[model samples]
Target: MEPLGRGDPRARRPRGAHGFVRSRDGLYRPEELYDATPYSTSSDARAYQWSSEDRSPDALLTRALHDESIDQALGRWCDPRKLVGVMGGHAAERGSQEYADATRLGRTLGATHTVATGGGPGAMEAANLGASLAEADDAAVDEALGVLAEVPSFRPSVDAWVDAAWRARALCPTPSPNLGVPTWFYGHEPPNVFATSIAKYFRNAQREAILLMICDAGIVFLPGAGGTVQEIFQDACENYYATGDKVAPMVLVGRRYWTETLPAWQLLTALARGRAMEDHVHLVDTVDEAAALLNRPPVSRPSAPDAR
Candidate 1:
């Protein structure tokens, strides 16, 4: 490939990009690096790996501005009012049934709603992959999923993992409606290749809030650890406070995983009892059911418990 940026007209040369060039859709592809370093490639993960000098105070401000600009651009690409997020563990991997189920949910939701993600691997990648594949057809998704099944995890090495993903893309280069909101704070985890529209940020807090706020329709929660749990509560807290004037659905994908395994679902539902967000809190056995929850109208935000 003729140096990723040199030959491609689409490669942007930003005025104050600070080593990060926000491309037409995905993360910036650094023009300086030779060989396919993470930053040089279009991989979302590379956007988080800026050198110390590149992250100097002056550069950080510029990068922050660039991230904001990218978010502005994304607002034009899809209706923020129709976004539905899929939240889950970044370690879910490719071949597992959990990953496969997430992919199906993305395909289902992406057909009618724009799929949003935290923009990392595991379940995030599976869902974004599904949304992208859905742009073509169901058979295309099946073929790509088979290719990914051969090399399931990126933890072993991103090179082999990325290679398999590229092979799948070559087989099915469908337009993707998956919007990824990733941050440099978790750069080691690399942004998954699936989201065609990525909003990479330097601030993790802002990214998290934006991901939850923009998903107007709802969010789907998969089995996860601390971070995912934190997200659930943060989102719930916001809806409880009616901070944004609207509260969306919060659907848990695995019934057993949410109830028996974690029990966070019980806590959330209990808190939501007799409240407006109650109708929006759903526990489903399949991806289809989760998608169905989004397809319906969100419940009104009832009067929250007295904060006093």
Candidate 2:
């Protein structure tokens, strides 16, 4: 073993009789310099070098934090007039009806508005892919799919995800820029390649929270699991409290899921009937219906009386 560094008390040891003999080739004799000051210094240098070379953990964390910041910045760029977000499960499989439906929804929204997502595969990829392909020429669509073909699914390498997205850009391009707010915590689920821009984050909670906060236009909820449930409640809380930018509409895509399966629609309806939350909730069974609800103007309320 060797002294850790210059600040270490053991580093002050005296040199040996041969003044710590060194080879002409610049290597020191191990035994002669074991307890020597130069040896300690060398140990410290090696330690420093090792630390510098081992940046995997720090690099991953740094990227995660950067993703959070990027998401916030992208949220700022979204035009509330035309920005629409879809919330659903990441587990949606490629080529499934749910995925295809979600993609069609994205394509419809992309024609006239910007579509946003959590930036992973399944629904996210479908939407982005739909939008990208819907707007591009056939040749462009082919190129775009080629780029995305590298990582067509979520459970794969990050490089594949990134490369696919880059290639897609060369093929089916966006008429209007869109955003992807993904997180490094779920690094396995790479951001969708179809998004014109990305807002990646390290912290899942912060990413989810911020996403709900900035979706001022509205949110369309699809069938999903834990993460989706979390988002639904977070949005409900915001609406319940009349938080920032006022409460936007909450659109549920599938009637069965919203009304029967999870039954969030019933819960929201009950809440809305109460004095504290009246008129703040709406439920729709289809995408067209959801779109109509989203486009409806905000309701007006009587102003509070002023104190004399």
Candidate 3:
């Protein structure tokens, strides 16, 4: 099927001012939009607390506003050609080797491309934290990781998780602009705040599709489970049919992870051969390899709304 938002005029606008204030100094507080609780405790994210009534009317309206506003802000600021996406598990905790590697990738990618993620904790937050710490030294990463190690996972407590992330940002204060597209449909997973701009929505399907559409440069897959596997084929199918004038790279990081552990690399490769997506597929061991392959030439726009 054709990707959603094809020939969308609103998707074509280039970067411009969004509806709210953004700071290049440090990670801004929870996005102050339809909901003021992005900075509040994680428990505040649930729809149940949205209004004096049930989480119905008010919550629904807020979601509509967020969807529209997020679409606008993304079009105004995103350059799909320079956008790189990293998909991975939401379980990778701070101080782990996996988290460290993902962070390193984010820092390096931040030097050129604007990093984007699913906007949750685990590997996603680690990548965002990496880009945020690029200007600092490794010691900064360690110190910040120490802070995040407090909760380790957002599953335990979203509030604690975000508190740790905010503390991490304060300790480092590295100014790297990143984008996060999260959905409230997965209410359990609070949106990660590593990105300077967050386009949070209520529709999971729209969020998933937009996330893939905006990744014109390419997407890197780290170790993950069912959801990540679904994404691999979703992107592959799009490439097989050749979306737009481009078939963005789909590089899998961690040879062992993608090959033996998750075993999606072989399937991805087999699907690519003799297909339009053949050249765009790659497999490597390190984050640097993933970034290098993904940053190569011919990264083109998708069939989605073209940004100005």
Ranking of predictions according to lDDT: 1, 3, 2
RMSD in angstroms, candidate 2?
14.7
TM-score of 3: 0.78
| lDDT per residue (tens digit) for residues 7-27 in model 2 | 655434332221211111111
TM-scores of all models?
A: 0.83, 0.66, 0.78
Please write out the lDDT profile of model 3 over residues 1-308, one tens digit for every residue.
00114455434432122211111212224544223444343322533234223345544554455466667667767844378888888888877888988888888887778888888778888888877776778788788878877777776566567777777888856467887776656666666767777766666888888888788778888889987888888888778777546788888877887888889888888776666567778888888898777666664443443222
Clash-forming residue pairs, model 1: 45-191, 276-302
Model 3 residue 70 CA deviation (Å) reads: 1.6
Model 2 is weakest, by summed lDDT over 10 consecutive residues, at 20-29
Give the per-residue Cα lDDT of candidate 2 at 86.
81
Candidate 2: misplaced stretches above 4 Å? 1-68, 79-82, 133-152, 156-170, 243-245, 275-280, 300-308
